[model samples]
Target chain A: MDEGRRPDDEKGEAEETAELLREYERQIMALPVQEHVERMLTTLSGLALQRLGIGEKEPAACSPQEARLAIDAFRALTEVLAQDEPERGGVYRATLAQMQLAFVSVAGGRAAGKGGAGATPETNGEDDGEAGKNGEGL
Target chain B: MDEGRRPDDEKGEAEETAELLREYERQIMALPVQEHVERMLTTLSGLALQRLGIGEKEPAACSPQEARLAIDAFRALTEVLAQDEPERGGVYRATLAQMQLAFVSVAGGRAAGKGGAGATPETNGEDDGEAGKNGEGL
Candidate 1:
């Protein structure tokens, strides 16, 4: 008998990738216009958090959960775009600009907070607790 | 005396254009990430509607309001990227992709609905009336 490749090998990966892409596109397509924007905002918030190095152990400036959602949305959007048009270079420029603004906002906000006496960088874990509490509402 | 020299003749058009660009940049910077994306989405939706000959008589298959917010977020993101490195050209690419997707979703959704017997085109006037009436809650 002639040796042949496994039946599932060729189709599995391609199918999986296609399914994933389709799912992502559907999610984006399903989003209400407002929700889509909200998703972008969430992504920006996450980028801001990353830039500020603010986490569970740090002074909570913004909600990490919201930020995470934003990042997920952004990723989904990007994946959908890539699947649709890989060759289009300017397609993502707008999204990038939005992300950059988010980063700057977080950076600037932190800088401003530091400038004031009320928002001092915490030395101990005490402020982390407060941050956690505040982050909960975020 | 030189009567030929007008009172406001110092490259007024160029100055105005520059000022407008700066204003656009500033607005983008101030917007939250999500808002930028929404704005872009709205613009895309409008473009799609125009392409489909769906004029203002019908509500877009997608939410124009939501898309507008996303666009704003994207615009802000782009402004920030352009500030850092105008030559990179990545930010522009991303924005274009997003716009394309938004347009495609609206146009495709309309076309797809038209092609399918089960799918019904929602009239612009009936959008609010049918908001929660159907299982579709987006």
Candidate 2:
């Protein structure tokens, strides 16, 4: 019986697997898509900070290109969220501002390191607070 | 005088703009690409945590799909870092494990909320310690 009638057992296993998949799909569909976008924004913000060496203490390791890319991605996504989820979008906008400020600070440090005034005229640490408040363009 | 001699002044301004751009390009080129990859992984890890609702106290906002996407992206980038920067790669691998564990724990919470045993049989708060230690696959 085991040798010749195994098709029924195989079919049962296949059905079980299909049922499991359906259940999984149902669970996934229950989650709000907005939550995913929020998570993505949070992640992109972290990436931007990392690119700027915010917590790493290695300003020399800062990558303006990567930080800019991450920030741009965050901004694009945030704009979409703003259209529908304005409240959450505003929160993300604040987060984006902070990341941009960090980028400027790090990039300024890089410029000073190379003995150049850099792109940002106000590269001094003294001016950072004001620059951030004023929303200086990147 | 203003009408006939504006071309030289305009040409000088264009040359200055070109010079500034060239300088900016040089600065961007100086940053290590490896640093960017590491930052990217760091960002992805944070995104996974956000998706898992780790910091938000809003487990209902958990999006397993987003969390899994972030984790996968982190893992893929980490593999590349491991090839050239083994030390940092190992650090990121450890970070990845923590994120995966968080994913399982949150997913378990969600399942429990739905009155199900969940994908992880050991969904209790106590088992989380060892489950994380054992590196349970997502």
Candidate 3:
């Protein structure tokens, strides 16, 4: 009787686990597309903002206001990606990638201006001259 | 005159790039949320199917038919995640994680079963006896 009971319990547990997994799968499959996109975009935005040093403890040398504006711009771009038209999605993706690349390039440029390694003295002088010109214009 | 000309050219290029970026950002921002979700879910489904060896050249040892069915199930799940509600996004993410974990678990279980890593000789014999009993019952 004890031997039979052990096998039955094991079978029951296995069944329960399988059922739980099936239920989980069903719930996941039921979610609407907009929700998933929103989640992914939100996650991406956070990652991008962190990389840009927006809202971080140490202020980036670049204007924090400009960084915030850039983040807002990205959010706007994500909204465009969320559209229903199939033709638009590809365009949006390519544009988004381009935007991200632009932001990254600007960040790299600033890092170079901060006297980082790989920045030649000539480039450093050029950056300083540009900064001086920007100050004068301001 | 040459120095002035070069700076003007550089500024013109910079302005042109910035305008292109702004236009791209505007286009993306105008997209509806539904399209965004569909794209994300489709990407996820494709990745999952590839991982499960559904489309890959290096086929897994599992039954191809079974793998196809599993992929279909995953596709269904992605369709569900494409719904419009924000509140359900968390549920969708959780479900995605669970589905991925289930695939990993099944793969690990098959490997362990093949290796006979945890099954003792006595337990194996008992399992064989149980199978024989089931066969006789059938």
Candidate 4:
């Protein structure tokens, strides 16, 4: 008897979303903790690549907003990686620097043409230099 | 018939190690994935703090090897979190950068004194700069 007969639809959609989130939690929990970590890193790398337009038809398939997020995600995780391992410290930074380069190569172009503020992955040069310095000291 | 009673002892030790690993896996799997990520980050922060002598009598409570493993775990989980959510880009970075700052404040001193290779939390200054640049463009 309701005008649109549709309040239930929205409720159902919300329920579906909740269920999907729960399912995701379950799938993630099913793996060993270390395994989960490995998978997540792999996923993040793939997402960064995709957003950068690595394999997609469009170069830089993601919006500038998405690029910023990818850049932040990459750096945050890289810092953690760099701090946690003394012997492997430089490896994660190197990987992150490369990813950031891929991101900057495309995002920088888009930002220039459209007048957007890009994440500026160019700083990795300094980071690499620092890592190299650290390596020599070690 | 046995001379030294050594085979049984080795077998028992191996069994104990396997059981411990299984228990660790089980404990990790009991929590939701998000909870796992949260705990991992917290652990990383605490470890960094301990290494920096923030709350403990000892400075560098963790060995470099231990730090490396912790870093790997943190980075892997963060990547997973970053890839999972589109709207929460800035949130994870904010959390991570803050922790890195905390790490830097303490670690910087120790690194300077001991001639140790630092974790490079100093980079966050430039990261903040980059984030600000991106924000203004938006």
Best model per lDDT:
2
Can you list each candidate's DockQ? 0.09, 0.02, 0.03, 0.05
Q: Across residues B39-118, which tens digit of lDDT does each residue of candidate 2 receive? A: 55666676677667778665654566556656755765566556545897789889988988787777655556654543
Name the docking class for model 4: incorrect
TM-score of 2: 0.36
TM-score of chain B of each: 0.33, 0.61, 0.38, 0.48
Model 3 ranges off by over 4 Å: A1-138, B1-7, B50-138
How much lDDT does each candidate structure score? 0.45, 0.61, 0.45, 0.49
Q: How many backbone clashes does candidate 4 have?
A: 3
Candidate 1, A3-116: lDDT as tens digits:
387657757767997999899875565555445444544545455454344542443435333343344345445544443246532445455455545544553354445443
C-alpha lDDT (0 to 100) for residue B48 of candidate 1: 32
Interface RMSD for each of the candidates: 11.1, 8.7, 13.8, 8.8
Q: What TM-score would chain A of each candidate receive against the reference chain A?
A: 0.35, 0.61, 0.36, 0.52
Q: Report how far residue B15 has shifted in candidate 1, in Å.
A: 60
Candidate 4 residue-wise lDDT, A1-138, digit = tens: 364969788788789979998998655543333343445455456556665566766542454334344445455655544443445547656766787776556655555444334323343332221221222111
Q: Per-residue error at A23 for model 1, in Å? A: 2.9
Per-residue C-alpha lDDT of model 2 across residues A1-138, encoded as one tens digit per residue: 466879889889889979998998555534444554565567667667766777765555455655665676577567656754589779888988888777777765565664454434354343232233233333
Runs off by more than 4 Å, candidate 1: A1-5, A9-17, A56-138, B1-63, B87-138
Using DockQ as the measure, what is the rank order of every candidate, best first? 1, 4, 3, 2
